[model samples]
Target chain A: MNTTQTPCRELQVLSCRPGTEPTLVDLVLSPPGWTCRAGQFVMIRPLDWGSELVWPRPFSVCDVSDAGLRIFFQVVGRGTRKLAGLQPGQKVAVWGPLGRWFRIDENRPNLILAGGVGIAPFVMLARREKTDNLSMLFGHRLDLCHYPYAEIADRIESEAMRQTTAADIAAFETVLSGRIKTLSGIGQVLACGPEPMLKVVRRYCLMHGTEGQISLENRMACGVGACLGCVGRTVTGEYVQSCVHGPVFDVRDIDLGE
Target chain B: MDQTVQLGPLTLKNPVITASGTFGYGLEFMRYGDLTALGAICLKGISLAPREGNPTPRIAETPCGMLNAIGLQNVGVKKFLAEKLPYIPPGTTLIANLYAQTPEDFGELAAIFAAQERVAALEVNISCPNVREGGVQFGQDPAMAARVTSAVKKRAGSKPVMVKLSPNVTDVTVIARAAVDAGADMLSLINTLSGMSVDIRTRRSRLANIVGGLSGPAVKPVALRMVHQVTRAVQVPVIGMGGITSAEDVLEFILVGAHAVQVGTFNFMRPDNAFRLVEEVRTLAESLGISSWDEYRGTLRA
Candidate 1:
């Protein structure tokens, strides 16, 4: 994309997050000049957001179709809270299709494990290529109805659970373990969610030696690697800026320890 | 609007240089705008060896600004000149911001840049903790600040040395004068203020380092006061910064006697902000009936 020409402009969103727990913001922007991929993201701020909210919030690009550029996220801070209140035709300052992307090997069995809104980037992944090898297992505290769970339902073999308790979480982990065992050594595991959830998935991937990629969500200021704010530690004991290197990192490259 | 401004040995195409650390290697913002368009690009601080820097959660958002303790992480000077320097376009004027553990190391780093003709000037960040003196900040002490300044000046050759002053002191002008008296060609103030924040629920400091440097719009008033003080204290050219958000802020620095202004934290708000500000500064200068920077600079009434 000629990103220089594509400065942050006021794009009209067809809609904001449809439910309270999970959001799907669709900005009325097309991606002709965009080379947007599944794991890449953007830093967005609604125009009306006062100076009180200093920095733009980063989100994984869900899907950028003719309908608009979509991002899935839940309100976690002042920035997201203000983003949640955005309505149709409201102008938003969107600067992205940024960071590294997930290069899905369409031929391999892909077991997608998502926690809460961590399932966001996978929607675009599911949309781009539909194959018999792909499936998603989503676990959230909020019910599946509160999420855009049904959007990719028909495209892949999907399973979701609402886990609010220890027992519920343990039961979900059993299901997660079973899925990794089922995928065996052949499948590539792509997981996203809170860090603890990623830690669990990372363990499963390691135990079964399943090759995959995991997208990270860190507190970020600049998405362009300049601010050096959002760095994730590598197993090699180096800090790489997730904003530039990979919000989407290889399962082997990162060290997400407990 | 004449865009050119001279600071000792170097002449900038414009007066809107991107602050060090904020602008990266200038390679990161290639898509945002042309690099040569700005007055100059000050790269992140470079040390003798690659610094691993601080732990994660290095930044936190404050009222109109933010706090960051990046630990001055950067590639060593050799790699910067060998790998990073060649990639930056030839026409673009580059300023190398140098940091070190001791005065001797500071001189060595200075000579590294001084030998490179591509590096137009040197910005010495005296705000760093001196390891030899048990980690006291060089900028916090006038004698220590002068020692570092003289070390850099002795090795910097004909390259203009701009000592960046810290605001976390009793009086910034004291250090500013010490630097000028020790042969600093130009001065830039104020570096981020020392501050901290906390998360009530977690009972943890917002930044991992506990204390971080605060920048952005929140520190403008304090920055202005310090710049005005330092300009009156020393004869060298003054480059002012702090919470500079718009063309008005750029001119405010000039009005307060800054020869030029460096746009820092505001660059994080928008990647193209510094590029866009060049024209905004010219137009704003014209609208205010300011002809040349020479006539308009330091014209603030008491």
Candidate 2:
């Protein structure tokens, strides 16, 4: 439990890209010593804002490097709309390398599933894990939400885009079931997306007797455990904070049912 | 410059205390800044038994503030004493925020802390809006608020008792007067205002608990107004908090007669907020040519 309050630093934007969507922005921030696990997130706020935008927004760690770390986000609200407008060399206050990350087992095969901006966390996971042992399935309602990852595409088995439809879901299930059956050893499923998508993934893991972990996206004020805002129910009917206990949790442990 | 301020019998090194529930036992923040720099560390709300708290989506962000229904999820008082108390930096003032389903529960918790030397005071939380039980119920009524205050004071022994008052009432001063009359040594106001948010896309409530306490800069004016009114109504020292984030906000509360101010939701935005606030207060005080806070305390003109 390395739950230290992440120091606030002014991260200089190295580059900015008009990601897969017009509203989505890809930012490269160079803040020295900014390190995070595959499923971890950072709390970011614009320095130029007034009290109107007081709370910071949480974003999953998209990618990392010695030069800096990358974050991908959509301009869904006022806070992010302001973030998307930031240019290269601009600085934003960032506090992170926070929250629990995915538990990677190198020996086992990995099946990664992501939806829309949920693809953010897996970018780091893909970079860390051995590509040969990894398989990815990405779903999107529109092509604009698809992220272009040239680096890890050659090493890993990946499906860049599967339309989010009833027909595509069945096809995805068949493809996923076949992949699971063909793996030489025990494999795990890791997913992040909307609740409906996560529910489908949960059912697949339950039916196949495979272990899975899902990263949840709850609206949060403090990325730390102090606020008790991002709580989710465990299978045992007890509530655990999604920020501290997890942004990532074992599928078996999370009780998604209402 | 004199930074120390007296709150009843207790003398705080500074006037910046970390509001309860946001600081989380104070040890978790050691890496961000110096914990001892704060006037006091008001530990998260504690009860006689461990609480699991509300269901998922317990928090939601509003226009300028956020709604949280944490339900005072904390380990029991005994566990807090055993696991958390020893970790608090030596010589740091620890104000235990006590909550319960009834006045008797508050009495039991107060008695437990009354025996601990390190426990400086008890911020009896009869104003929490998240819990469905005795929190806001006791805070809303002046008589019940007095009863809870007296119950904790009776068992608190030598330790001072500060009654935390809620702003979700018709006249907060009436409740403040009641707590003061019931032997409350000091008062802290105003707890989060009751609020809720909804998701238009799903046509469902954003928080699983449906409603929660709203805290942040959004509630500052309301909190300041309540603190101002209560200070004029009661003789006990006042610790004001509602959306205090800056040095100016702290000064505004002091100008309205708050002996000290609590930093709450701002801690989430900046972990070292208390330290920064302490320095800001010092610099501001020095610039104003004031030797002590007493010169400016309650200096707000009509």
**lDDT values, one for every candidate:** 0.84, 0.84
Q: Could you give candidate 2's fraction of true interface contacts? A: 0.55
Per-residue accuracy of model 1 over A19-54 as CA lDDT, tens digit each: 544443333343434548888998887767655666
For candidate 2, lDDT tens digit of each residue in B1-302? 98999987899999999999998998867767788778999999999999998776777777778888888888888899899889888988899999999999899999999999998999999999988889999999989999999999999999999999999999999999999999999999989999989988999888888988899999999999999999999888999999998888999999999999998988877666788889999998888888788888999998
Give a tens-digit lDDT track for model 1, residues B198-248: 989999999888888889999999999999999999999999999998899
Q: After superposition, how far is residue B40 of candidate 2 from its true place, in Å?
A: 0.9
Candidate 1 whole-model C-alpha lDDT, 0 to 1 = 0.84
Q: Give per-residue lDDT, candidate 1, residue B41.
A: 93
Error of model 1, residue A165, in angstroms:
1.3
Error of 1 at A48 (Å): 4.0
Give candidate 1's error at residue B116 in angstroms: 0.9
